[model samples]
Structures are given as structure tokens and as C-alpha cells.
Target: MHSSPRIRTSVAATVLALAVVAPTAAMAMPTAPKAPVEAKKSTQNYKGLPSGVSKKKTLVIGLDGAAAAQINEKNTPNLAALVKNGMLAKSNLYANPMAPTVSGAGWSTIATGVWPDKHKVPDNSFANPNYAQYPDYLTRLEIARAQSSTLVVGTWSPIPQKVFGEKTDLRLAGGNDAGTTAKTVDYLKNGNPDSTFVHLDEIDGAGHSSGSSSAAYAKAHATADAQIGQILAAVDERKAKKSEDWMVVITADHGHTPGGGHGGSSTGERATFVIAQGKGIEAGSVRHDVKISDIAPTVLKHQGVRIEDEWQLDGQAAGTIKADDFDSLRPHLKTGVDETKPGTTTTGWTTTAPSGWSIDNSAMPAGGVTEWQGWSFATDEFWTNVDLNQGRETSVHNRNVFAVADSDEWDDKAHAAGQFDSTLISPSYKVRGGKTATLSFASNYRIDGPQSGEVFVSFDGGEPRLLKSYDKNFNGVETISIDVPKKAKKAKVSFRYTGTNSAFWTVDQVSLKK
Candidate 1:
């Protein structure tokens, strides 16, 4: 029997399926409960409504692990239509450097309008989540205004039933896209739900079985687009029959790697998009700055729910919705370096290698290549799992940068580990206002035998001061921040990789900001 395929619950909440991979061991999987359940009766229902001529309702479609680059006019017609008439943005997901990027964490962030730190869901296990402190938006809606009808459905039972853990007016579980669409259509036509959420699982599944850029994944994307069209059509039909004014929003929890695997801090894994189509949204407008956590507050605001400061959410309403608080939010990296290509050189970086460090573009995972010994930057295709070369295709760590020692090299020999005793120094840059400079960068490293990786900074060419260090094993793309010396007029950073190495050190998007 095949093992159960790894399933990522919707990073966002919805009743639709976002299962990226089909269950491998279908027999081992429990049968999905066949019907919908009624929500618990509320003791008190808040009757507050927005004062307007037309009633307002919300519909959110959560497409799990969908990438913006893959969606377009021809492939995802429905999504395209929404974009043509709405606002779209390449939104960023707040990442936890220490945790694996999975469904539980992503979904919780989406539901609560906060990052993983607030929701406290770091992995798929969903242990010790701080739901009481940061409950899902639906739960907030149910509690604040119990009279409003809410619907939540998803094929992934864990997400709908456990992760979000909200009791809506109507909740459905376990169904294919066709079934989900039909049920959603019936509910929209017959019942008037103030808020609705739908999830889709097929595209993510295809991304797992076949690579995200593969034909199978493309087909799955098309299928999801068609299904979304059906759901929108049903909403329109409902509008035709009634005086319902609906605001439709769509978003994804995460993006998949080119090789069809995720859970890293690579660009592809963290990149996601948001689409808001409503009366206020600007048609065909594109935004670069947005976040997945912004969805909950936006939806609540549109529904006339007053946002309370006591909730302590991390997101503000984005897109067309006016939000004055978002101005305080700014990019962590204002200035930096890129060294992920062949023959790349920094004007100020000085290298100290007994064997000399040079820029090259190849690596030998199975064995060491003599030609790659002096290579400066790590090649994008140098993953330990070489079979999944495509994984290096998209959002690769700045196209893969490297810091290695003279003896360090990737080898095919199972036990042939070497030490990397080399250092690369950065150019001197002014730290404005004496102490305003702070440095941050993404680094990925692997070590096998002994010793470790270390980073140091020399202020005005003073004694090297240690900043941070790492031991053996894998440290995925991590953002490390350090404070520069206030007294130093110039700062030179250094990366030291000196230890028995099974894996090399790679850094990218190095930034020094005031």
C-alpha cells in the first residue's frame, strides 16, 4: 500500500480542498464524514449591521500553494477575470526562520490576520496553538456577531475541522472539486450566508506528484480555474435571484518549489499573491506590497464589523481599503548584495583562501569536481537531491551563492567529508548616523564532520568580532540580523566556513540598512 501523501492544510481558511498531493495510501486514509454539520446555537447574537442601501456579504476562495507566475488569462480564466475587475498583489507571507513552512502555520496566519508568532502554529502538528489569544476571523465573527451566517468547507479535514477550529453556521468536509462546487452553489442559491469560504486542493496535489512547472501541474491549475469559474457563476446566479451585494476575494497560502517540494525560506516557497474584487477595489490595478495576513481584517471591515485594538492583529486592511497604520511597516533590507551567479564579484569584498576563491557555476553532489574547488558562488543545481534539479529553477537563493574552504567540496563518496577553512570579506559601507546601520541576509548551510560556520564583522578594520555561528545539519534559508558598531565609520563583514563539511554554505540577498 502507498503511504498517505503529505497534505498541507489550507494556509488560508475555506471549505474547499487544497490538497497538493493525492493520498498515496488511499486505503489507509479514513473515510471523510459524508454530510454537513450545524453550528452550535449562540446564547446572544449581535444585531449590528452596516448602514447602507445594499446589504454586504463576503466570499473568500483559498487556493492552496498557488503561484502568481502560473496564473494568467488563458490558463486561469476565472482568476483572470477577477484580476481584470479587481486589485491583485504579490503578497508576502511572514516567515518563521526556525519552523517548516506548512499548512497548519500558513492557514492559522490567514485566519487570524497575524504571523506564525502570534498564532503559534509553527508546523503541521498544530501543537499548543494560541487560538484563544488569536482566534480565526470566522470565530471572531461568530462570537462578535452571532446572528451573521457563516459557511466553511474544505476537503482537507484537518484544516477545516482542526486547524481553524471554528464553528460556522454551515460546515462541510470531504469532497472533490465537483462536489464542493455543487454544494457551494446549492448553499448560495438556497441560503443567504453573510460570509463564505471555499478551498481547492487539486493544484497543490499536482504540484507534489509532478513538478510545479510540469505539464501535470499546469493541467491541475487549469482544472482549479474551471472550478473557480463555476463557484463565481453560482454566486452570480444567487445575485440575479436576490438583492445580495457580494465581495469576492481570492488568495493562496504559499507557493511550491520548482521540484514540487517546499518547507524552505526560498523565494518560491514564500511568494504568494492576493486578489480582491469588489466595488471599491481598483480594476486591473497591481500592487507589490501586501500580505496574506491582511485578508481577515479586510473581510471584517467590509462586513461592517468594528476592529478592536484588544484583538492585537498583525495585519491592516490592504488594497483599495484605506489603512493609515501600514505606513510604519517597511522592508527589513534596504541595501544589500547579490552573489548567486558565475564570475560574480563584489567591488569591496576581499577573499582570504589558502587555495584561492574564484567564481564558478558548477558543483558535484555525488563527488567533488576539481574544476569547482575555487568556485566562489554555489550553483543553483547543487542540491543534495540532484534528481530534483528543477527545484533550483525558481526563486533559487539569489541564484545560489557560496562560501567555502580550500578542502571543502561536495562529493559522491558517502563518507568523504572535507573541511572548509576559507573566509570572504565584504566591502566597507558607511553606517549612516554612526549607529543606524543594521545588517541582515538569508543564508543556507550544511555541515557534516566537525567544526562549523561563523560570521564576523570588523568595524573600521578592527579586531574581528564574532556575530553568529552554526553547527552541523541543515539550516535553511535564514535571515540573520546584526547591529553595526556606532563608533565605526566603515564596516567590513566576513563569512568563515571552517569545519568538516558535508554541505556547503550559501548566502544571498545580503543587506545593510539604516
Candidate 2:
């Protein structure tokens, strides 16, 4: 598990200084801004079978220890070609307590469609895995569709022996990357498999022998690319003869450090990516929200499998993923003014609300970090890179841009006065009189020092009523039901946070339903 950094004197001094400032009267509620015209939703299709395809098939390729940032056209031409024809999505992995950025935890998450907290594969030892409760997707598919054929070949023995299940039609352990690629190519060319998974390990071996920055690592990429090219050729030949639709997805388990090691929370070690090309998937598109766990569900989706809600899978199909209003702020994000760790060029953390939302900083202090003076919308890359190894990596459930109230990062710079306090107001929603409405949102709250997060609701301009108050660590989607009083027509929700050099609170994918 990662440990918190020691609190600096500047923050402690600021806390003492703020203790003397007298409290002022409450300010009036600010007027909500006009909602912008809703942009036309993209016509890009991510579901259903393509026009000519009668049969659906899936192929998943795993490249061990390959970081998304290191892949380029020069070294990995075939993988780059897949990106050119498909979608390239970058995502990070959890570290330490959740699971170290190791192959055991990473591959388990991809195979089971859940996080380490559920799968219980905390390290390479593979102790007390919850596979019986949450089996590999292939095994689940076998149970759902008895007639479908499945195959799995892995260069790493543990993957085939322990990760995949006994129910798979065929599971083989190839001694090395070349052997694994050859087996996969032979099967695609001669066999009639409905779904296949292949794991290549030479790239990871190279990283372990020579650092990721070494020439040997680059050579490994070239070799792996060639192997992937051969596999793609086999797939093309099979497609031409069988007249089938194939959705191919390529991804990595975890990334490597510059010096060739992993199992840490550094940006390099935690980095992972997804590249997919096939029916219903947009061509030449890029995404920042897809995660490693998405591969299992995406494969099941392409193969016409119904995902049950009771499974409690942590991933959604890549094609079916949609962006929320907060994600639309990506282009408008600004470079950091006080956060020097992520550098001055990173465009992230904007205080400007998306459309109908507003941030109330009327009770906030004079100076903190400009990026986090109030509730700000930010991307994962920008926020997590500020300081590594802080539980921020566990914010895996949140996608794209989300709301953040970070007193920890804000205290990194010199502030004039006061503790961190901000409120995020939501757009007014239509509510039925005398009926119950549910407010649902994904929240991740981490507390280091003193901090409090409270939720309030007001109806028809009535006084705000408390719904929930958080003073401890909480993570997951929260659903709170509110009884609408008689004759109520409209309701507005608010989130207020107060902290003194504590951790952070992130909110995303908020909605209200009756």
C-alpha cells in the first residue's frame, strides 16, 4: 500500500492562520447560468452486427508490459495500423492496496471484468482468487452459449493455467511469444473458433532484461508487431472464406518503468491502453475513458452474449460507452497556473461549469492553487500526475472528466488565507409533486486530515434540506432517495465540501430519476 506524504509546514501554518479569521454571514444563492444548446449526438454506431456479417467472432490480443505512450508507427507498425483503422484508448491501473501494477492483478482484472477488490488477486501469488464467484469471461460465455467454441493461448503459463477457466474449449501454454503467436495463427487459419484470446510475453521479457528506454525494448516491439501482423493475415484469410465479422481488440496488462520494473504507481508503470477494430466500432477514433477491464465485456458484447446485471461487472462495452456533459469540457480545460508537477503545458482543471451547473466560491478563501480554488472539472491524467502513489489510481470507476475538490493538491502552493471550501450546484430538474425522486452519482472520497462533504436539496426555491453528510472514506455509486413535498415542481441539488489540507472528493455521472 502507498503511504501519504508528510504534511508541509506551509499548510499547517495556513490552518493556524485561518483559525483566527472570523466567520461571515451566508451569501445569497447565485443565479444558475443558461444551459447551452445540446450538441447533436454523434451518428457513429457502436452496436449491432455490421451490414454484411452473418456470424460474429472476437479476437483479443494481450501484449505484456507495453505502455501506450511508448507505442509508435516507427517501432510497432502493425499495432499502429490497428490504431489507424480502429480506436486507441488510454487508461491507468490501480496500485498497491487495490493491487500492485503487476501482471497477476492486471490480467485478472481484464479476464474477470472486475477490479482487484473483488477478484482478490493482489499479487503474482494468486492467493484466494474469487474466480468461482466471478469467472473468466470465456467461462461465463461457455455457460451462456454451450455451442460456441473458445480458445486461449498464453506465453505466460500462469495465464493459461490459473487465470482462464477449465470450461474453455481449449487452453494452451506456449513456451514463448513466437510459440504463442504461431499457435494463434494456426488456430485462426484452420479452426472455427467463435472467440479467441492470445497473450504475448516477449515485450515484457525485453523490458525485464533491458530497460524500456533501451534499444532492445524497441527491437522487441518490432518483433511483436511482425507477429501480430502474421496473426492479422490469418484472420483476414479466415474472414474472406467464412464471410464472418471479426472484432479484434489489442491491449496490455500493465506498463514498465523506464528502468524496466513495474508494480508501482508511477505514471509509466500504471499506464495501459486498448486498440480495437471491427464491426460497430468507429474508425481512427481515440478515447481516454476506456479501461483494461473493458476488454472482457467488449469481447462478450461482440460475440452476442448478454451481460447480466447481477454479475456486478466493473466494465462497459467500449462501443457502447458515452460521454457525459462534464466530458464536453475537455477542449475548454486550461493549463495549470499553480500546479508545477504536471508542468505548465498540461491542459486540465477548469473552474468553468459545463452548461447549467455553477460553482459557488463566494465562501472560498482568497488564494490556493488556481486550478483548484473551487470545484473544478479535470481529467485523470492531469490530476493523478500531480503527485504519484496517492490513492488516486483507485479512482478507476470514474470516466473522462469529473468534478474534483482537492485540498491536498491545492495546499501545494502558497495561499493567502482560509481553508478550502466550495459548493457545486446542479441544474434544476423537473420533479413530480408528492412522489419520491432518486439522486444518483459516482463518488470517490478520501480523507487524510479534517474534511467534510455534504449533500443538500432544495425544492421550488425552498430551504436546502440535508440528504447526506460524509466525514470518512467512501467510494462507489451513491443513490439517495428524497421525498418531494406536495406541490413541488422543481428541485436542485448541491454538494458542499470543506477541508483543511485533507485529501479529495470526486463526483461524476450524476443524474436524478423518479
Candidate 3:
């Protein structure tokens, strides 16, 4: 687990005390539920503007510290309506090293379309932010389309003062949540803004004052939900008068611990969500691949701004995201076995590989943790819950179900065999002879003790050649160019991991393109 710097304040101390006294209910994991039915794709031609609508605009509402699991039709009718009409995506955040699950890092990642490692705002102090390189989405819109108007209204001063750039048309700092909502509502109803962002901080304050499981937290959500309803009403009134298309996005920066406070690796603290309704989005869809970083790109894409490759953004547009082969295994993922930290009832971790892919554990460990004995497919929720604060939470880039080789968890149980040795083999792909092919995959490799992660490529069923070796920490997508043999017609890729009471390696979205 990543370490958080001490917050020097009386409130911080009080929150810490509350955390110890009232542990979150999530600490007691529930029995594994049945696999969820796959979401159906919309068949409607959800492209281009609707009839009579000429311009495309967007509104992003940031509800600080609101947990997705807590929202429902009873408590948050307005937000629940949006979820029924659009899409709700549950996601997690990083802790410590990458950045604490605090407002500074969370909001920055949402605005900049990148993680804290790139934005450099780890804590609330906002020391040395790299907005010059990765500016907020609204700032990027101004640079890309100067004629477009942008507005940012927030209760949190740092958001409008530091996170967003000065190029935005209007930046307002509301003294409180009511003030922020008033300013935003006025703009949406009266002003002709192309893109707008509103941040509400009352919910987070409520969480800090009272535990997330407390009635005060629920009341805070109700208050914010009413405020959001006002904002949505303004949008509707504007849409009724003008022939315009509006996209609304509601999201949270981070979640509070059950007993309040954050900046830790607990499941509740790491929780974040995205609820979006707009053109091209499937109604009532639930997805797990969306990240907080995706908010910026999603807004940019909705407003018809061309995302430049030079920007090096880490997020893809939410509506445009297509599920990878590994993501398709969600419905097939099995409940936990031989692991009891979060209980053996969690519905994650599957040793079954997708069609055309295979896992080889012949070299073999005999009696390790059943779930992680080999390359296993898993969701972030299950894998991170196994052991908190071990840096698994930092794998924020990989979304949905990804392949993991966790010897650390596997070694928890007594084993009758040698060290963990497993290989994940990819299906063969056709390649042009003498041409360079790119092998792209998202990889997060952490080393502890003695461990090795190697990537190999074989051409035309010939001897495999070493493509890359991982001996240190790596945490992003890797694109390697491989020169095909003069007479080679096909290629297959493989990821082999070996460890002895060491850390782990996770790989996902593997593809080979010429």
C-alpha cells in the first residue's frame, strides 16, 4: 500500500479517530452474487446530432466524495434518472505513490485526462502541477477551438483557481455548494456556454463530519441531488428554447471510508463513479472500464474537438470505448476460492481464458491459492481486496477484467511445489513478411524479492525471440515495434511470469497490428 503524508489539522485527527472506532461495513465481505447479465448494446443509430439540434454542448457535474453504491432511486432520484437514461460506470483510484485518493489528485486527473503521475498533484496542496503539459479539458478546448465558450464554477477554490487554466472564458469560485449551484444554474439557463464544469463539495464535507454510513452523509447526497435537479432543469429549459444537444455527466472525485476520511487503499476510499447521459451513449448501460480520467476526453469528444495525439492523454472517450477480448470475460468470471480476506464469496478471479488464448502452468506450483495459481482473469474489486495497500490499487490504467499473475497472493497459502511460473499465450495473427508489426498491451509490473516478467514473440511457429524483459516497476501501456522475419507469415505473443514470494504482473488489451 502507498503511504499518505500526514495532514496537520484537528479535523484530520478527529476523522482518523472515527475511522478506527467505526470500521466500514465493506470490511465484512458478502457472499458472492451470481454473475451479472451482460449489458445490451444499443441498436439505434446513435450518431450525429438529433433532428432540429444544431450545436453540441456538455455539462460536467462533480459531486465530491459521493459513492456510487450509495446512490439509488430513493435517495438520489435525479441522479438515478440519469443512470436510467444514460450509463453508470463504477471505477477505482490510486493511493499514495501515484497519488492519495484526495480531491487534488482526483479532480486533477478528471480535468487533465491523465493520472497523478503525469499531472503531479498528489495531495491537496497542489505543489508543482503540470497543467502546462496536460491542461484541463476546458483549457484544451480553448486552445483547440478559441471561438467556443467555456465556464467553470466550483465551491473548491483550487479547482477553478488552479486546476483549470486562465484561458477558459469564465472561472467562478463559489463560497459554498449553494453558491456554486446558483452560479451554474444561472449560466446554463441564461448564458450560451459551449462547455461547462460545476463542482459541489458539500457531500465530501458531510462525509468528513459524519461517517459515510451515517444519516448525515445520506442527507448530503439528498441536498446535492436536489441541487443537481435544479441544474438539469436549467439545461432542459435552455434545450426547449434553443435547438441544441446537451450532454450531462455526473461523477465523484473519490469516496470516503465507511467511518469517514480517505487517502487510504480501502475499497470505499478508492471508489469513484461516472454517470453520463448524452448522444451516442447507450441507455441504462453499466460499465466497469470507465475511469475518472475519462471525463475530460469524453467532454472533448462530445463537443466535437479533435483529440490530438501530441497531447498524450491517458483516457479514451467514454462513448467510443470498445470492450477488449479480456473485458468480455466479465460474465464468466467466477467467485473467489481459497482466499478469505474479503471472504471466498467475492465474484471475481477466473482461471478460464477467453477463446483462442491459453494459460500454461505446467512448470507448476501444486498447492497455492486456487484463484491465483496461474494467470487468472480478475476485476479490480476482487484483486485489490485480497490485500490492501500493496500497490494493486495503483493499477488505475487497466480497466475491467485483465490478466494477473499475483505470486504474492498465491504464496499466501502453503505450496507443495516450486515457485510460481505461468505463461499466457496469445492467438496467432497474420503478418506481412518483412514488415514491422506493433505489439501493444497495457502492463503493470511490480517487483519484490526475485521475480521475472518476460515477453516473447514467435514467428511462423519458429523459435521464440525475446521482445522485452521486466525486472523493475512499469505501469502503462507498452507499444513495441517488431520487425517480422523475411519469410514469416504469422506471429504469436506470450507473457511468462516467474516469482517466489514476490510481487505481481498484470497484462491486458493485447493486440498486434501491422
Candidate 4:
């Protein structure tokens, strides 16, 4: 995760700098930041393993805080080999923006094949975690087959307790990376567990101690490569002796900042990669992007474990890679809003000129700015002011680009009075043979007071019918389901933003599915 080891600077910078910087006697605090509200942890217990077994074995290697950018043949030869022989070498799989890019949440996403909504791990502390309800894949495997052997080895002690859970039969949680590697190799050679998970923390430690771009980080990665090479050697020997098929998957929980901190949504922090090498995986078959949740299902599928719908898994098997299929409401419509500059044509979708929607890249009133190189707009808020020297960027919705309808001109005033209305309509969709449809999009809105705005749907040149109404403070993604009336064969959607006094509405990634 991004925010850690609070490094305070006495000199001033911006709102974010103040947010993270420890207070000093010489400085007058800009504003006492509100403490983050954590979600309540659940205490539900799950059932034991049902009787079943898969033919193939599985191994998962998790590298904490490893940035894809830092990976190279010269620095990490063993990892390079795995990538060269696996599906991930040519693919671009990103960790979904489910929660902050932190170890506990990212690893939970990897282990459970679900987002934070299901696992409920928001940070590293594992505070109020709901892992009992959403157990790890190892635990799921145990549930499927009570007699199956499972092993977990990690230098990070919390990973075994917080991520792998209680199902594993052999857990070597504490020790240095080398010691952990020795244990994993020994277990691979002798214990022969059906499913295994290996966690390495030194690379991340190096990133935090030395910058991610530094030589020290590179050396740490190299040392880890040597250790992994030894473990792989054991796996090869086991495969040769037993003639057993195995699937090996490798991935990282999150990426580190250049300065070695994480827990934010910056591109660097969100950077993650996955590699699948073994039975049924395509060699040199590259995928453009994959989610971390996909790893669990992919591994299970390879192990011959049946993934049922009742499990409510968010991932699919890695065997088949397909283009966008409009099974969900979002795949039908082109992107009406994306991370693009104001006045520029959005990449996938189009809108009418009369539409009041425009992108806003300037610093928000909350003191967040999109620090893209092309962001030339001047920010005027006192707390929002910050130098671009450290290359830190902030966004209102954790992104640089967003569609906005603001009440005042960019540089004019603090707030505006009276109504400021805007509508962003979608390109027409021919949903002739489709059933009920759903619309989803991410948005952040602010008003002087009270709720204001509505989402509407129109059927084939008919009047717009209300879909959903905005009545309170909302700052995240919203999905609305609409049943297509029998009379309509085609439909169009629009978000009507209406507000009085000071207000602004920002939207992105609008999609529809039937």
C-alpha cells in the first residue's frame, strides 16, 4: 500500500503533502484531515471441504510490491524465463481498481478471486477483515477435498494468517527470503503438496529502503530470482520423478512508488503482472489485460476444479481469451466518457455539440490535481497548490481525466449561484434481441446543499424515462438496471446533471450491457 512510514517535511507543498506529512511545531495545519472510516469486519464461518480432487497440481508465487517496469532479463533472469515460457510475457494484465493498491487488499484479491467488496480487506492492518466469509483459494481447495495437501511459505508472517487462512497443512510463515526459499524447495521435493503458495518480501523491502529505480532494488530482485530459480529446480525434479502435471502461476500484489511508498492509485502503484506456465497454458499467447481476481479461477480451472456460479467468482479461466463480449450491460455501449482532455473527442464514443459535458483537468476544490504533462490549466485553491517536482499526481476520482460540468469558468470564482445543468447522452444502441439491460459508470459530484441529478433512458425516439435519481452524496461507481419495455427495440441513455448554487459533476467509463 502507498501511504506508510509517514515521512514529514517541515517545508510546505500541497494538500496531499499536508495530508501525509507529520505535523511540526513551526507549521500551522491547513485543516485537520478526517480519519478514514473502516468497514466493519464479519464473523461468519464457512463449511469444510467437500469430497473431490483435481488431477493437476498448482503453485502460486506472490512477489509483494513488485513493479512491472523493474522487471528485465538482466535483473531477473529466472522470472524472465517464466514469462518467456508463459502466457503473461506478451500480455498486459492490470489489477482492478477495487481498493487502494495495498498488500492485504491486493493479496486478498489474488487469493479469493474477488474484489474488496467480497473479501472486505481495505488495508494492511487486516482490521475488521471479513476473511471468514470469503476464504482463500487454498481453503476453497480444502473444502473441495478434505484429504488434499496444501502448503504456504512466506517471509511475511501476516500473509499466512491473513491471506492463506487456516486450511493449509504446512505453513512456513516466518524467516528470511532465503530460509523461506529453502523450506519451499524442501516441501516441493518431499511434502509434494497439491497446492502451494510462496511469498517473497525482500524486493518490496528494498523498494521502500531504496527507491524502486535504484540499483539496490535491482539487486534484491536478482537475489530473489536466484532463490526462485532454486525452487523451480526442485519443481522440475519433482515433475521428472513423478511424471505429474503442474500449473505454476506468478504475480505481484502491488507496485511500489519510485520513492518506495505505496497504497495509492497512481499508475506506478497500480502496476501488476501475472504469469501462468504449465498445463493448458498457451506459449507466447499474450493477453492485453487481466484482473488479479482472474488468477484464482485460472489456477482452479487448471487443477480440474469446477468453478460453480454459486461461488460468485469474479474471474474466468485463463485458457480462453476473447474480445469484449457484451454479456454485461457495459459491453454494448462505446466509452462515452474516459480519461481524455476537455473538448477532445472521447476515444470510443461520440456526443452532440450542444451537450454541456466537458472534461476538467484542473485541481479540484479538494486540492487534487491531474499532474499529466499536458495538464496546463492553472489551479487556484490555496490547499490545492503544490509543486510538480516530486512527480506526485492527485485526482478527484483517482484519475487524471474525467467529464465535468462545473458552475463557473475555470478561473472565475470560488463558487457559482443559480442552476447549472448538463446532459451527457450515449450513442444509440440496437438492443433488439436483448433482455433487461444495465448501465454502469463512475462518478463524483458535489453540491452546495442537497441532492440534484437524474439518469434517464429513451426507447427508439420515445421520451426519456427516469432510470435513477441522485439524492445524496455519492463519489464512486453507480450501476443501474433497466428492463427493456417490449415496445422498444433500440435505446439511448443520458445523465442529466442539474444543480443550484455551487456544484460540479464528474463522470467516467460509462458502459451498458443486456
User: Each candidate's TM vs. the true structure?
Assistant: 0.57, 0.87, 0.89, 0.65
Tell me how far the alpha carbon of residue 45 in candidate 2 is from the true structure, in angstroms, after superposition: 35
Top candidate when judged by TM-score against the true structure: 3
Q: Which ten residues in a row have the lowest lDDT in candidate 1?
A: 327-336
lDDT of 3 by residue, 30-123 (tens): 2222223442212321121012222788899999889988788999999999999999999889886688888889999999899999888888
Residues 252-337, candidate 2: write the lDDT tens digits: 99888788778888877888999999977788999978998888899998877878777888888887878977999999998877
Output the worst ten-in-a-row residue range by lDDT, candidate 4.
Answer: 10-19
* Model 2 misplaced regions, further than 4 Å: 1-54, 239-242
List candidate 1 segments past 4 Å from native.
1-54, 94-98, 239-242, 319-338, 341-514
What do the candidate models score in CA lDDT, each in turn? 0.58, 0.79, 0.82, 0.58
RMSD of each: 11.4, 15.0, 11.2, 12.7
Error of 3 at 258 (Å): 1.7
Tens-digit lDDT track of model 1 for 451-511: 5677787777699888878865443344445566556677766677654444456555455
**Shift in Å, residue 220, candidate 4:** 0.4
